[model samples]
Each structure stands twice: as C-alpha cells, then as structure tokens.
Target: MNAASLLHLLQFASPALPIGGYSYSQGLEAAIEEGLVTDADSARAWIVCYLDEVVARWDAPVLWRLMSAFAAHDAGTIAQWGGCFLASRDTAELRAESVQMGYSLSRLIAELGVADTRALGEDVTLPLAFACAVDGLAIPHEEALLAMVFAWVENQVLVCVKSVPLGQVAGQRLLLSLRPEIERAVELARRLPDDELSNWAPGLSMLSMRHEVQHGRLYRS
Candidate 1:
C-alpha cells in the first residue's frame, strides 16, 4: 500500500485515536472477576479464545463484508450488514459499546472529512465506521483487516495488564505469543464464506450479561 494509506490505517488503529476503545474491555473484566482469567497465562488463554472464536468467526468476517460494501458504495448492503452486526450483540452493554464507538468515530470522520458515514445511518456500529474510513482512505483490504485485528489484540492485552495485574513485560510477552494466532485469524476471516460466519460465543456472552449487574466494574462490557 502507499505510505499515506498506511499512515491513515495506523492512525485509525492507534490507541490514542480517542474513540473510547481503551475504556471497554468487552467482558474481560467480568471474566477476571469470575476467575476465568488471572495472571499472564489465563489472560493469554482468554484473549486467544476471543481472537480465535469471536473475532475470527464473527467480527472480522463482518468487517471484511462491511469494507467491501463501503468500497462498492453499496449503502443498502452496508446498512443490512450493520444491522445484522448490531442484532448479533449478545447484551445491551455490548450493543451500546459498538454504537457509542461508532458514533464517536463517525463524528471524527466528519471532522476530518475522510469518509461519508451517512450510508451507515444514525446507528453506525464500530466496524461500519471503521470500514467506511478505511475505504475512504484507500487502505488495502488485507492490510486493513490486519490493522483491525492488531488494534483489538493490543487493547485486550492492555485490559489484561490493568485488570489481571499482569506485569508490562508479561503483557508484551503475551502479545508476542499471540501474533501467529492473529495472523491465522485474519486469514480465516478473509476466506470464510458469509454463511459460515458466526457470533455464537455463549460463554463470553454469558459473562457480558453477568457484567451488566456486576458492581464496581472496570469496563462497560
């Protein structure tokens, strides 16, 4: 890809992008409280499961489809896929997180004049906003997916570091160890047919539901 596109993709995925990604753990905190994740090893396992199961099977593929829809300027397809994505959210908090992040990114995209998010309508989900921006910036599809996966992996690691009380070095090590799996997931996302795509992560979804009423939680979901 061209340097400008690469830079834009980096900026989109950066932790400092200020879309509130850092504030949400996507159920990691609930897992920690339940002792499903504790210390480096458990944290690594939890993140790996999320990557392989939820992301690889669901979010990444949906993102791939959304990016294609944006590139084609198919607003109808974008809305259809976006709605499907939102409906798949297992809990209220998870749905809110996606919408809130999407709204934030939509506003930022408007300010930068980088993408026309009107196609996504008012309730744009995070992947919809991201796919639109990537297409608008002319980021290549495979690279865009890689960047998205990397950003999520890094954020999950950061969540583990803070909540699991894992050392920075251990978190870094965990990130390194998961690189191969990340690459594998990206590939799976690229090749998986639409019919095969799924968001059937019952265990994780249950944790998210439990997190809704959990007192003194660190994450929104």
Candidate 2:
C-alpha cells in the first residue's frame, strides 16, 4: 500500500476514467419513469437493494474472480469469466453497457502503456479489463475490490440524483448510508464461491428492457 499504488487505484476508479459510465443508469431511469423510484426515500431504497442484490451478489464476485485470473496471468480464465459475466446480464442493454465500457477501458489501458492486454481479445468486459489495470498496479485483490465497490456506489448515486430529480444533499446522504455496505459487499464477495455467482435481477431486467423502448429517456439502461 505505497502512496503510488494507492494513487493508481484511485485514478483507475475515477469517474473521469472515460468509460462512459455516466451514460448508463442500469435501469434506474426506467424505474423513475414508472414511479417505482419517485422520491429520495424510494430512490435510496431502490439503490440499496440493488447494491446488495445485483452488485454484491453478482458484479463484485465476478470482478473478484477476474482480478484473481489477472493476477495469475490466466487468459483462459479471464475469457471464461467474461462469458459468464455477460451471460449474467439479463437484458441486451445491460450486456452492451458492460462490453462497451470494457472496450473503452481496454483502449485506455493500452494508451497508458499499461500491460498490453490486447491479447485478451476485443471484448474484455469491464470488470475483467478493470481488474487487469488494478492487477498491473500491484494493488491487492481486496483493496481493488473495495475500489470497485466504491466506484459503483458513487456512479449509481449520481444516477439516482439525476433521474429521481433528488437534491444533491439527498444523493450525498444516500452515498453516506451506503458507505458501510461497501465493506460488507467486499466480505460477501470474498465468501462467495465461483459456482454460486449468478445474476438474478428480474425487476431490473424488466426495467432495462422497458428502457430500450422508453421515450424521452435521459439515460441509457
């Protein structure tokens, strides 16, 4: 945990990292449209459940495995995990969001003269590509997982602030409430076996599918 490695992890998780993360609400926008997340309380509640069920249960664990594979330099493992990760996305938009972000991050990594992970193929999903960057920095897996969880929480909070039309204070409050959950999420992901990880957000999938056809949408699903 030298200062330089810490800085690299922060920069890797920076919202300005240019992965187009702000563009996708991951179905929050559709939920807002349907009045499922009308106010600050509801918005906060929705995101809390989403963090525990969708992110902690699926994305973080997938990311954990990806980080493990990257650390071992196991390209086959990375590719296999990428397939499973995409399969977990219940909707087409969700799948595209992961792939597009993954591609953008991969190019950014190459541009930074990070390890030439170009051999990981054209479609290295976000978590895998992100793990490649974090592993390159020599950040430990646990620290990297925390960074991923924080970044996701921050991004989804912004999604709520914009879509739910909540004030900045409410969004900040929501983030504060979720801070302790990041450690819990990291712990949950660690204890999760690879065979047990699966995506199971039917409500989110329906919202995302609806978002594909929703009119006057402010964000992509």
lDDT tens digits, residues 1-221, model 1?
Answer: 88998899889989999899999999999999999998898988888889999999999999999999888888788888999999998799999999999999998998999977665687789999999899889999999999999999999999988988999999899999999999999999999998899878899889999999999987888
Worst 10 residues of 2 by lDDT: 115-124
Flag clash pairs in model 1.
27-221
The local lDDT score (0 to 100) that residue 96 gets in candidate 1 is 96
What lDDT score belongs to each candidate, Candidate 1 first? 0.91, 0.85
lDDT of 2 by residue, 98-129 (tens): 99999999889888887677677766789978
Candidate 1 residue spans exceeding 4 A from truth: none
Please list all clashing residue pairs in model 2, or write none if there are none: none
